[model samples]
Target: MNKISRKGFLKIAAAAAMSGVTAGALAACNAASSSTAASSGAAGSYTPGTYTGTAEGISSTVKVTMTFSDSAVTDVVVDTSGETASYGAAAAEELKNQLLNAGSDEIDGVSGSTITSDAVKKAAKSCFAQAKGEATVTSVQLPTGDETDWLGEEPDIDEAAITETVDTDIVIVGAGNGGMFAAAYAAAKGLNFRVIEQNGNVQDTRHWVGAVDGFGAQEQGIKMDRAKLLSEVSRYASGKCDQRVVKTWINESAEMIEFVRSIMEDKYGVKMIYTYGDEAKWPAENAEHNTDYMYPEIEYTYDRSSGAARNELLLQYIQELGYDVDFKTSLAKLEKNSDGRITGIIAQSTEDDHFIRYNANKGVLLACGGFPGNPYMMEQLDPLGTSVTTACSYSPSDKGYGIRAAMWAGANLDKEAAPMLFDRGVVAPGVDGGYVDSDTAFGGKAFPGTIRQYNPGTQPFLKVNRNGERFANESSPYNDIVYAAAHQPGRVYAQICDANILEDAKRFHTIGCSAQTRNAGEAYVQGKMDEAIAAGALFKCDTLEELADKLGFTGEAKDTFLATVDRYNELYDKQNDEDFGKPAYRLSAIRTAPFYGCWLGASLLTTEQGIAINEKGQALDNDNKPMPGLYITGDMSGSFFANNYPCLMAGVAMGRTLTFAMKAVKQMAGLE
Candidate 1:
């Protein structure tokens, strides 16, 4: 008998343990099987019995169960072994289904687990080959390609590869809500069109997002007053957003909503509901209060009624369109004829490493988002700003791929406009302080459930710097809080709130308590919290004096910090924010016992800079002229918002840009 090495034995033992089979039991079974196989091999015309073959470099084991009646390949069961939970299990199940139905080695790869699928295929092939006395094991390589494969690459113009080119009425990049709308509109007009997406799926972010609102006049039973939406967005934009863009969004908002509704109901067979709930009131009071500064008549919230269902439906609609929609492809380079006419796009597949030429018979629309995920881009855009990102709450793919593509194409850069950083409150549990999801702190005033609520608003808390002195209003906007934290020395400190406020927070928002408290929230509710703790947010002591000692505050500064808290509390109790003019509802004193402080780190939501585009959604060069054949939209295009974030009815800007791109396509194809 061959001796099994310790490493091999341990691996087998681990596999047996995971399968809920004792190591001794597995060893006995293996010994019996080996003896039976050896006896069978000794007989003439004897087929090899079932063998568990473990492949190298794959996370899973392949169980090859073979049954032979008269030794003529009667049945085969290829059960993938050693699969991880969730994704791996799903992949294994899919493999099993494929094997059962096909009874062949051919199998479709599972989405999001391509490597695992390949591993299974290889293992199954090896088992079958060994049974048939043929070579089955083979090496496989990981898939790769340029940006067009997964990051939405552009076309290669250096070579004349597109020989049989046909003009498309419109070429839209990205398959998000914006790109989808553009394609649908073009199709409705009986125009030739194609959409290019770097993602492997459509409506990628939308499918994962929890809720969305602020579409212009609701259509398909989604009813929002246009005038009200415009006012609300204008106020949120703080007089910095382009009025034309805002107006265009309002005018077409209802149409976009209606379009989405139609796609959900008619095509996808999914019902679309208002998100703010049935009462027509904003879902949360915070949304209402914030909107008061903009449009008082506009309800602050509406229930989409369902998130998961809506996404599934919307994706189905896009798939049904039958338009030339390419996925897992990226834009490599833009093509322009010497005449300066924007012509075609060069795309590459990340899986196959093949370049596909997509001739934009009309024009190419860019609907990529901002560059908040790019650290280098952030520094260039906001030299004075601290490095904080909010994309962690959203899509991991929201990297500045689009922006970089545009820049490489000589597109103009918008220096002033960028996404603002917002605070994500609540750090990882057991840590003194950490980063929190801005939404937890600012997501409608309702305490973001237990998993996120780290700080109470009414707490008599002082945001002290390393010097242990109070800075900025505790009641300031969430973004402001993040900014202060980022600018502070070491970019961290404790937020000293009194015990009474903590108790109230615990009572009202169960999740806001520390880990030490029962029913406490998760260590890190948001993706960025882990990152923030690495940056800073510490918690310390019960009394102001103790906290001061720990934080290294001494003498007059400590006294000043206490005095400031007292003065702020006096104003808070009186419901008079004379110092900061904070609203009465937000004013509250922190004069309670057993004070506690949680450290908070600042993180940003949007990028502060992006590619420059005009009101027409045309990408412009540094010379302020449109880059022929190129258009940009979403966060990728810049100069839309100034100092503050824009509130253009949710998905309005994207909808308008897509619509405009469709129109441009029509004009290019001489169909207009």
Candidate 2:
């Protein structure tokens, strides 16, 4: 095995690389050494049967099955379906070959997938133990159903042990969208603020920001009804959200849009355009939108060399204004005064593991994001949301550290979870959606057993569960079908469309980010579908029956699938859906020559539930009282969302994040 040198390990550990490896890495190394010692000379002799061993991977459990002969290992299979498709999953074949060649679990890790590679070696060691007929196997403990608290007790940091101390007007806990906005406005007001980010740079940015009646909307002659918008958002939250926060976004989002335009366009020379401008594409024949949903002209985009450059501009802008962000600094905890008022925070430097105290005279703003990246937090707070997901695209830095710190300081978190789920997780043949055995890394976990995306699922196509029965009104919002499928057998469903997909998708006219595939023309759509088919993420067949069989439908399932297709055709011909009340224009038939099918689960974007805050962006106590020097923004600030994301509003989450970030800065500066 290629073991890292002591110097190399120390260097990486100091840099905080490879998932916060310090004490954990030392423990893991010791465990591996002990396991190897226990199974020292048992490589040649083995029991001649197929043995399976499992370990937690980046997202899901990685299972290694080996068939052994009397003298040599014959066959080896490594299942990394739960990992990132291009990274860990793609490295499975190489890892398997390495294990077989070495005749043991001691093998070099794969490039770009160190976590999954380590997991594979760990699990392979277990298989070696089982082959030797050992009394006890060496394996990491998987989650048991008897677990109580994922969030344990808070840390006790001694003030005397602190290495350094600094005083500032404000302390920002992240450099993401919310943190950047807060920092920009803080610099504009000439506040001596200290911004710290755990990440090396700015996190990935979402493409568009939602607003209402901004300059873009004004130029496009679009005006939205504020009351109706508020009502629609409130309805999406099941009336559990605080309307005061919703109304704050609704009324101030336009101003936020204008302010961002001034900085991004006028100051930074970036051109911003309305997403639903005059050149926007919509179905020509059916021009009206569904009344049950709203597509307000509120989103705007900026031209950039890369997908994230527009957001990164904020950091550059802040730097130019004589403020710098301290990268590789993570929040330790929020400190409070004797009167029970938040005063400042203790932060740990990831570089050398030294603690530094930063006293904030004004307030501390936490924009470190929500807990989508933390499996323990997700499994605890958003069990159902995580249960139905099969993939995650959220930032790894979003581990709910900010929320937890506030909670330790007597902040209340929203009881309900509002996960931003999209219907795009593409799974292979036999994989299903639900929680899986996740890794013990601090980086984060992905939803297991899926690839990047299956964009075709975004269209209002004919969907059938594993039992091959239509289970939902396919014309509903993005996440509705995924949520409905949670009750199905495998917590999954298949989206079946035919050769007329090009024309049908055009007619479907899906709004928001889902429209990218359709707008890219037939060539792009077919290319993506062909790629998915090659990757085994999709199934293509000439007939509906063949497609059903290929998609794992058997016996009654195959019969029900064919029947469901026929019934859907009948609904298409009648131009009405009595079964699910789907709009006739969105109804697609599956009778074309070449048919396509793909099993889908939800792709989690982020969690919107966090420390509860008021309209002023002040972190609230259990009694709904504001904490004196604690503010929250981005996903770290909750009480504004519940259930699922309101996708119909375009980029409302991003809008609310930026809006509240600025609001928090103003309130902390006594301007609000």
Candidate 3:
């Protein structure tokens, strides 16, 4: 066998037509034998051989490879590359060491990575079983079908196999921002509701919670043009979105914020702060009308971590109210009556795979998240999104199950896909942007590369395609760059800058989430850049030519890159952008030494389109009539957004989720 680089293995594994027990699996083993004895008395003897096993992880499959000898465990490798970066992926090394040191799968799990740790142990056990010749091969292959078939046939669950049943006034699917808020309001209204989530705890991935004309903005003396905001959102969606649903958020968002403040602050003693885009500003030359797209103060906790802190308190408050969020419970299917009214749902216990029936007397709210983590849905609904996206912040829980369940129950889905994209997914040289045909535990295409977050990529830098030609105005909305790059060569672009990046970013004054690094000061920003440089995610060189070569610009592409730089410098010197109509203040010449380059596509935060709904948060049928006793919220609900998520408002997505969650609960309780 020929020796292959790790990067080569990753690239090959992604595109390979993998069957049961793939060759990549054997190659990934690359095992080493050891005679080291077990440290604990429980360490049992094993046959001398290399073995591999796999199990389901937080987002994808976790594979374990082990080499064993009589009375000892030798070398071990845990492949957690598919897991969440901050949690499961980070726990890989520790889990590997634990397996080797203990000589058994019974080892302590890493903190905050329980799911991955459990998967590692399970896979390790299977490896040990294989080493012992116990005939236990535990790897399961994902389902595959025609490329265009994302909504496969509905599951034919056996009714007699259900182990138990429960009754409730309201049944809420998911314990994310939408479901949690719905539960909080339900508890307050004295409604007996059950909230079910597949994950072990609540999901809080974002911080900002946008609202229009909320008390926080009022206290700060900030005002908004309702009509202008409405028109801007309509324009963003190309008028495909339901204006009535958009208007509902515009009208009730203030009330939602106050309700959040009441629970987080008045009840839980967690102080919240509301902020407008004060830290970022457009150039003075750009008229005030250009700033009309900005939002008023949005609510947030004290810091990034505080968002989760407040959520923990909210969970405690719900538990104290004699209600509980059922974790490790996955939705199976929606159960409806013959009258076309949703009656309840069938949920599977993630721990035991046993099915349980939940009967909702009032209504059922589907706040389960979108399909950013589900590759099947991405391939079918948003192939362009799947191609350009490299990373996802969503979890395995967001498998588009809620949306599919609604569709199976006669709900109509949005004809167009709406994905919330950010210009931050950083790739390395030679990696083209496209969907990788890797088979995952969740049936979808995997990202082609190991991408990192290039937050500063949000700055309006001089971006060029593989042919080294300037593509578009980088100062536009985040998703616009991704869409534009889709039409470019290799479906990827390189962001080029110079040593004056710190000062340039400060002057760029990009608003919304882009302003985060700019506000963090030069030191923080430089530190991040340095870290990226150290990680080989960024290319830094003394000359533009060297930078171009490092970024994969060859021959004519290199010359074009040099010419593009010179032309960009000319524009910067003239303080005008004639090609793309970019604001002059945002232009920064790439003349300084020690140039930097990073290949980018887009990072997916979540998908924004799903089952179509009305202003009342009720799912709509094919005839545009509301589906009785069925409500939708969070990313699972659509019609308020159509094409791309409007990130200019910071937390509009979460705000819309919470606002409509309240609407759904109230509507079910007869208060609407």
Candidate 4:
């Protein structure tokens, strides 16, 4: 054996191809004694030696030193100094154990600390390849960007360059679901109004909508204790929410939703149905849950996922009242009078490239959704740039034009955390990857799979990060799994399965969408898996060792991957999961050959961070005082969520949007 410098590994890349690692891993003649500190079966290209290497991690850089003699790793030292020492400490400990178990540079990444784990693997590989006199080293670069990109510089266009003007008592910006409701109430109140919609029509891209809140529709005869509802929401808001505003949200949701329902059903005969899925129903009778979170029942507009809803109905009602809206028109800015009061609005026609001004005699309301389509806004809210992961929020890239118009006009904005979630979906076939079951990732469209087809991709089967380490409880709900994935090294995870896993999902009582319907046959599901594997959405390998290597596992990762499967199989045999407690039925072992996997990025519904508002639905400034002549509704205001979407509040975003629209309409029209 020959001694080499740290850089020696990089020097041998071309030379090591003649004797590749794992070339004869299983031969009996390869055995070496423990005294030699080498592989018991001295079969691969390790070349018996010690070496060191370095790699980048989540929050820091990591250095690794390894001792491999006779093709078997005998010792490992991980230096995770770059990762805020405390957080990296535990990760280092976990990585050491994983490395020792595999006795080779093929092992699992630490679940909670993927960045450090990746660093360890890369570092180990440097040593292994160098020891083998090989120069080739695998590198896994993390995806990068400011995870939050929604907040950016305000629009720079001058407002004085107005080309046209329309004077009205009330001017509404945006024609989405929330804006439409405000428009209808203004129309009903006989207030002079004009609506500027960026899209050609009232289009909303939400498939699921509904909320179970405190005060439901009184006329519908299902109401909760208003006081309790108010207190609950106020608590949920964590003192960050205006108690008064929360109270109004609780008091008005039912009436607003019911009123819209009445207008749509009684007049048009259109019906609302409960959206069915994982989030469809409220929490059941269980100790870990309460009833109030179950109060406000959620229902969806029948059929069309992106079709008619309350807002669409409200748009019709506004038209019935003889109010006309400008399609393809966008709000450019809001002008204030010398007294600090909102006076008028400037807008542009997307169709003709022309600007129009609307003088507001009474007020101007901005109900465009939270800056979902603005990358600058995302950058501000989520510095990690996770928004770029998938097409969860697919609104027109108006870059939050309406929200900025409000902010520029002296309206206050809330800088709270907004977490995007993937309700369901799969890695799209073509482009990088996306949620296929719930969201469209590639080409702005979803794949052709019935719930039974793509649902298997999302079911809570065993999963691991890029380092081949199980990072979460595979049986947990969508939110838990997603939260884990978001914090991983690359903010990504792989759902592990053998070729037979799909068949097991079909044959056994798998949870998630599978519990709702029978999956496609085993062959069909395998075919789908193979297709995803070919597209790189999913990885396939003849052996687990290959799977571990492809995922960037090193040292003990490969051994741990096999051991993990064996241990999980033992757990499955006993019908109990001790490691993660994944429900027994979901505990199928990864035994079959030609293993498969789908890489899942975090999924999101929509982003709803926005301008703060008062109980009166008036836009508030930094001082928490309402900005006169301005109001926000829909996704534009009343988002009190701290992080994850409130569980059991299916469609609460739409609920709040509609509720605030009603209140904002009343306030802007001076009816409050």
The C-alpha RMSD in Å for every predicted model, in order, reads 14.5, 9.7, 10.2, 20.8
The full ranking of all candidates by TM-score, starting with the best, is 2, 3, 4, 1
Error of 2 at 487 (Å): 1.4
Candidate-wise lDDT, in order = 0.47, 0.75, 0.75, 0.57
lDDT of 2 by residue, 52-166 (tens): 6665456556778766654566677799887778888999999988887887888997988887887687667666656665413222232110124445434555444477898
TM-score per model over all chains: 0.58, 0.79, 0.78, 0.63
User: Which lDDT value does model 3 have at 177?
Assistant: 82
Cand. 4 TM to true fold:
0.63
**Which model scores highest in TM-score?**
2
Per-residue error for 203 in candidate 2, Å, reads 1.0
Candidate 3 residues 427-467, lDDT tens each?
A: 77767676664434343256654544668988889999999
TM-score, candidate 3, is: 0.78
> 1-672 in candidate 1: lDDT tens per residue?
222221112111112112211111011111112322101222323243553333321233335454322233334444544544455446666675564455445778577655456545545544444454442222211111111221222222323332233356567777765566566666666667777776667654332111123342222235445566566565555655556655644453444455555566566555544423322231233343352322211222123454444433444554566655777666655667887767876665544434566778667877655654433344455634433322133343455666656765778776564454434444422222222222111110111112222333223245666555666655444455555666665555456655454344333221111211322333333232334334433333567677555545578767866776688778767867677554455444566655555555434444535566655667788887888778776656665555544321223334444445444444445663
Worst 10 residues of 4 by lDDT: 19-28
For TM-score, candidate 1 versus 2, the one ahead is: 2
Stretches of candidate 1 off by over 4 Å are 1-167, 187-190, 206-241, 265-292, 296-312, 388-391, 425-462, 474-477, 484-487, 491-561, 592-596, 647-672
> What does the lDDT read for residue 587 in candidate 4?
69
After TM-score superposition, the amount by which residue 543's alpha carbon in candidate 4 deviates from its true location, in angstroms, is: 7.2
